[model samples]
Target: MGYGFAWHPVLLNSLLLLAAALLFNRLAGRRYPHSQPAAPAPTPSERVGVSRADLHAALAERGEVVDISEDDLEDILQRAEERSHQRRFGALRCADFMVSEVLSVSAAASSDKALALLRDHRFDALPVTSSDGRLLGEISLRELLAAAGMHPAPLVGQLMDTCPHTSRPDDPIERLIHPFADRGVAHSMVVDGEGRLLGLVAQGDLIAALFREQLERPA
Candidate 1:
């Protein structure tokens, strides 16, 4: 009985610490909400049977049934058509869909120029580059807040968290998703084996793909 009384304060302190940690995690998560963990995505094999291209072709066949079987084809296509065009599960493919048009800011370019581009372009991120476009660092709205001289004229070169994660045109997409799980980046620059920028794989792009697939499926 004496021992139990002596341990009361220690147990209470441990419970208090646990509650503090929970509160701290919630507050920190609000500041960096994108870092929150996501549900596991489905694999290519799961999505392979009804490819987007094939579905689009079905929907394009307006009133004419060329040489195809209408009943059988329409039945197969209806399942995908009724589903919400919103994305569900999937991985990203660099070559099949990543955007190749990557706009960049120059390190020597003034902060005003960077801010202007951020406003003008619809993109959520931009890579920084040399006069010749050397793929320096990148800038996003998160980094833009410091451009008011609140800090150094934060050079795009300095803001790049790290070199972009790139993949070959032929690299299996499942492998690519693994690196994205822990990175600070929300997009990956798709590149060739020679490291030439080809396109970008923004998180939105993957979500868009699923929507596209649904749209193309037959009703």
Candidate 2:
């Protein structure tokens, strides 16, 4: 009887210990849950051996692409920007920026007179006009020199550029972009409706005007 009684107490003690262990395990599991497994690393083919289609797909992930390549799209954007600049320039008139105090020469002026006038004003070219102030042509230092080489006392009209580029006061400054900006035409004659000289628009003047306008723009 005594041995059976002692075995009962020991067995009861063992059962209590087992129960406490089970409760502790349940509490521990609730306190710190197991972490999720990490994502698998990309394979060699995905990492290094990407195909051309895959390259395009990656680039197009943030945008759509139709028939144009990336370079073609960039070119189209650049041309659009250029057109926008031209439009902005078109808003300004030629008379507003042309040099009003234009130094000109008579069509019958001598080379010595032309040279003196150019040296006095430090001008690249001078508009050659008729006595009635009509636009005749333009004479530059180059023309004067060429004429002087041919004759000792050369006339201004002989070597002048008869087909000089001319513009109207009301015309947009954008008109100069082609002649001055693209074709490298340095000087232009601003004439009135009656072909009378009003002013002169030179490349330097246009550039200065554009720079001033840019500086005065709102930040």
- Tens-digit lDDT string for candidate 2 (1-219): 688876698888888887787778787874323458796664432344333455567767968657767666544544554467666644667898898888889978888799889988888889998988998998888877666545568788776888889989887665565566545689788999899999988888778877877886778
Per-candidate TM equals 0.48, 0.58
Scored by TM-score, the top model is 2
The C-alpha stretches of model 1 lying farther than 4 A from their native spots are 1-92, 150-154, 179-184, 210-219
Highest lDDT: give the candidate number: 2
Error of 1 at 84 (Å): 25
Which run of 10 residues does model 2 get worst, by summed lDDT?
43-52
Candidate 2 has an lDDT of 0.75
RMSD of each: 15.2, 26.9
Please write out the lDDT profile of model 1 over residues 96-165, one tens digit for every residue. 7687777777777666567778788766667776665455666777677565664456556656545666
